[model samples]
Target chain A: MKPVFTRPRSLADVSTHYCPGCTHGIVHRLIAEAIDELDIAERTIGVAPVGCAVLAYNYFNVDFQEAAHGRAPAVATGIKRALPDRVVFTYQGDGDLASIGTAEIVHAANRGEAITVIYVNNAIYGMTGGQMAPTTLAGQKTTTSPFGRDVEVCGYPIRMAELLATLVAPRYIARVAVNSPAHIQQAKRAIKRAFEVQVNDHGFALVEVLSTCPTNWGLPPKKALAWLEENMIPYYPLGEFKVPKEAE
Target chain B: MAKGKVVINEDRCKGCELCTTVCPHKILALDPKKINKLGYHPVTLTDPEECIGCALCARMCPDCVIEVYRE
Candidate 1:
């Protein structure tokens, strides 16, 4: 028998510490698959974020650097600049990217750095016991916002993909989900393209993946996927918000 | 029908049961009788004959515990 679907070579052969049904594992697998498909495992250097995936380096076989809370983009920028030959990327969560590391991400994209960013937006902060994050939807109940997020006071959830797409320096910006098989496949393509944009020296690229926080959301893994489709997708519509002019 | 087989890394599974929902043949289920070191019911192929090797279960699995093969 031919093995058709197995673990990606870029992924490590150990169990992850993610909670039962956490979609971080899925996103990690997707990134590893992209690295494997691109054959850039040897030259790939990933910057791990401070949120739940702080230990992301242990899951992938590529060289990794640990960045301070919300400093992944800055770290990645330094790495990419120092070693222009290496393929640099950052894996960050909503709290790291949209909240604490907001300045870092905005400047990194605005500066047109030749780096790939895997931004995982699960809305609430997962690593810190489900506190409200900048990307948390309005009226969403979180530990920090027990009465639900009030748009009047908290403002609306920041659509990172759309925000970055508005910048002229970015070569590509996409928003995808991993709630189902179809979306997961599309997410893989987007991630691969983000890396391709860097490989071609096209400038900065970011793929904001709408992920699930089953434990934080107080829902089972299966229902979390459904909830994301029904709740998150409408607010943050899925699609490539920006692409290189030549590819458009 | 295309013949397919699925292998589960029993220890690696977090027993999220996400794969059980996406299986087209519905051949996957949590084994209530057995628990892994993680203290969770590991997923098992309930009926291997019903599996069409679609790999949907593997794709949906968060932990990458399922591997699919085709004959």
Candidate 2:
């Protein structure tokens, strides 16, 4: 017998601190698998965000830099510029990228930095006790928005992938989900392609992954996956928003 | 049926029951009798012979707790 599936080499053997059924772990595995498949673990440098995945550096066996809340893009830009030969990527949550670090991410994508970004959007803020986030869907109940997010007052959720895709400088921009096995496989492919864009020196690449926050969402693990598919997918449709002409 | 088996790292599982939902054979279930160090019921295969090694459960596991082998 031969092992058909096992943990990727890029991922550390230790268990992650994520809650039960949190999709962050799935996304983490996908990124690690991408790094392994590309054979870039030795030269990969990950910028960890200041959200629930703050301890991301401990999980991935690679050189990592801790970025200030929402400053992962800025830190990644510096690293990629300083170490041109190294593969640079940032793992950021919606609260980190879409809220506080909005300016940093926008400018980084606008500048066309040769780095990959794995953006996890689980709608509500997970680490800070389920507060409403800029990406939180309308009418979605959260700690801050107990009455549910009102589009009229709180405004509609920001679609980061679409926002980044509008930028002319990005080499690739995609959105994927990890709610199911099929989606996980597609998400893995998109993550790998995002890395490929940087490896090929194709300016900036970002893959926004629609993840689940079972703890914050007040739902069981399985229901969270279904909620994400039924609610998040309709608003933030999954697909590659932009791709370099040659790669398309 | 394709001969295959899965090894669950009990300590790494958080009792999410995600693997059970995706298992085609419905062979995966949380071991009610045993709890891991994390205080969650660990997953176990009920009938090893039923596993086809499609790796759906392994793929769905967020913690990478399951390893699939095929013969």
TM-score of chain B of 1: 0.93
Q: Which stretch of 10 consecutive residues in model 1 chain A shows the poorest summed lDDT?
A: A196-205
Candidate topping DockQ: 2
lDDT of 2 by residue, B1-71 (tens): 64998999999999998888899989999999998999999999999989999999999999999999998
Per-candidate TM-score, chain A: 0.99, 0.99
Q: Evaluated on chain B only, what are the TM-scores of all the candidate structures, in order?
A: 0.93, 0.95
DockQ of each: 0.88, 0.90
* Candidate 1 runs further than 4 Å off: none
- Model 2 local distance difference test score: 0.95
Question: Candidate 2: DockQ?
Answer: 0.90
